[model samples]
Target: MSKISKLFKGVSGSSSSSKSKHRARGGPSPHEAIHKLRDTEDMLTKKQDYLEKRIEQEVAIAKKHGTRNKRAALQALKRKKRLEQQLTQIDGTLSTIEFQRESLENSHTNSEVVRNMGYASQAMKKVHESMDLNKIDDLMDDINEQKDVAREINDAISRPQGDDFDEDELLAELEELEQEQMDDSMKSMGGLPSVPSGRLPSASTSYRATTKRREDEDDMRMLASWAT
Candidate 1:
């Protein structure tokens, strides 16, 4: 008996040492824990199915033995009750394991979110390290000044050259030119000869007629005096 006890103790010690060694290598991560929980749940589910089948079979037997064999029916019902109890226990265990798994998963997600937020905060801090309100304002002012200068340059470049003439002087010169043109046109019209529209004699013909008439008159007068 002592030897048997020693053997059992040796077996237990070896199992414990193996577990400690495994833990030393790397304890079960959350992911592994979740996987283990899922496997356990699946095993429990199969067990529950088996229990349900056994319960059904017991019920069928109890029905078959009805009043003819009361003892057999009683025994079958008892076995069914025990299986139901085991099924209940397994259901409770599965519920606990599932709740733990879900809680761990939620914790992991929250931790990741927190870690990422911390990283983001650091990045924002780094980005802001080189910046200040005053510097930004100065930059903006410089940009505005440059824009103003550029606009002035563009205006100067785009302006028409030789556009310094006075408006009033230009208008006066234009009026003088118009007047000279009018005067020239009038003089040209006056130099043109007028045409006779009716049967009036021309200037040369009228002059010649007048001269002959005067000569005739003088000759007639001389003859009258000689006669007197």
Candidate 2:
């Protein structure tokens, strides 16, 4: 075959070889990427083990609370199991990507091929997925601790309620809280001049308005007395 014909045939073969996964993402051969991904998975396993221990501790605390809503611990376990299953799938995909790398064309476009071979590797995807798992684990731990504190407070409240639940003081507190909230809302409204749906101004604003009204009433009385 002529050199031109041979070159044409090779180009045709290269084009035929290029597929969806081979779209270039950047550096890193498929083998190197898989190795790095394996390392990441190993690190996650250790982290998962530590989180697992903390989860057990939370479970024990929930039991002491009289009502064990182990939702956080249970969800953590579920997410850990999900990571395990994903790790297995990642392991299985490694060989397929390696094969694709070996079969890649000798042309200078191996980077593109490497990039696409990476796409099908579940290990690469799992590393990204692990980020979300870690975030969720933190959220679960926070919510669990918060709930545990709330439960402890509730248990205390149930005990022979002898502390003179000062009704007047409580009412005053509610009024103060309502007033502060009203001031905050008014300030917010003052910034944007828009009427709220069904809410009214807080107690502080009402008190101020009442004071102005009383002053007006006194001034009217003085005027009436003077005129009479």
Candidate 3:
């Protein structure tokens, strides 16, 4: 059988058996498995490098002694071919190990995800177990009742307490008192001298009338100030 094919069969047999018994036998965890696989890969990579260097050396030997020393050249070529075959096998092995490590990493991630989800579900279930719908409803009802009571209290505080008065009637009565005071002031002035009906008043009479008008204006100003 071909070397590669034989190598694949061997790897498959070992891997299958390991997987079948891994959990049952309490074997390595995913972390440990991946770590071991990585270690194997490193070792095989080193071997590959060594084999390649040896192959290079053999090729150099064959080239340097070409034709002049056929036997030595032929021996070097044979050694080179064997080293190349070993390098090829190490390459295949490294590929398999890398693939296995990646699988373990992915599986470990999936396991962690599932476990955390289960924890979340259990937490929700516990929270639900502690809660009662009836109690929640009662709490809301109490809150609403307190709100309504608060509104009623605010309304009571804001409303006028007693004896509501008509603002418009009070204003009209105040104007009437101002008019009566003005009439009393005119009486105190002995009233404007009656203008003679037929003709303009004498200069003296005009002077009294002007004085009377000035007094009336002053009284009106005083009344306005008092109102303010």
Candidate 4:
């Protein structure tokens, strides 16, 4: 028995020392540690439930031996009290375990957040490795130069190829043409009757006057023929 006890103690000590060394070496990742803590919390909670049930059972037993069996009643009460104490201990232990588990979970979450942020930072660093302000400036200058060349090409394409005419020369030629047309029209009007400078007599008077003049001219023509 002593040998067995000693062996068990040695084993326990070795296990504890190994666990301590594992902790020193950063034993479990935060996620793994949180999961284990949660498992412990669940176990403690089950124990708490069991202890509560046993306490209730002891209370019932105490009530059953109300007066007839005072010794049994006392024994039952005593057992109930011990069970209640155990339940209280379990409650405290559960609180502690729950707090520890929650703390581990929060720490794990924070660690992941920091790790992801680091990864993002590294990714950004890698992305920027091939780029610099000078290169960016040069690229922009090239783009602007291309745009200017494109604009010039578009302008050249849209412009008239070879039919350029001077606007001033064209307008002067048009004016000369108009002047020639006016001169030709004036020459054409020369053979037509001229307009009267003054107002003429009425139609009836003018007709009578023209007829009398014609008769006189005919009488003169007759006299000249007789003389001949």
For lDDT, the strongest prediction is 1
lDDT of 1 by residue, 73-128 (tens): 99999999999999999989999998999998998889889999999999999999
Best-to-worst ranking by lDDT: 1, 3, 4, 2
Which ranges in model 2 have alpha carbons more than 4 Å from their true place? 1-26, 67-228
Largest TM-score belongs to which candidate? 4
TM-score of each prediction: 0.55, 0.21, 0.53, 0.56
Q: What TM-score, to 2 decimals, does candidate 1 have? A: 0.55
Q: Candidate 2 residues 165-209, lDDT tens each?
A: 979999999999999998899788765566779879899999999
What is residue 31's positional error in candidate 2, in angstroms?
3.1
CA lDDT scores, all candidates in order = 0.93, 0.70, 0.92, 0.88
Error of 4 at 225 (Å): 62
Better of 2 and 3 by TM-score: 3
Stretches of candidate 3 above 4 Å error? 1-25, 140-228
Cand. 1 Cα-lDDT: 0.93
lDDT of 4 by residue, 1-228 (tens): 699999999999998997998789889777777777778778878887887888788788888988999999899889888888888887888788788878888887888899999999999999999789899999999999999999999999999888889999999999999999987998888854777999989999999999999999999999999999
For model 4, what is the error of residue 176's alpha carbon versus the real structure, in angstroms, after optimal superposition?
30
Clash totals in order: 0, 2, 0, 0
> Candidate 1: which pairs clash?
none
- Can you write out model 3's per-residue Cα lDDT over 62-123, one digit (the tens) per residue? 99999999999999999999998888888888888888888889999999999999999999
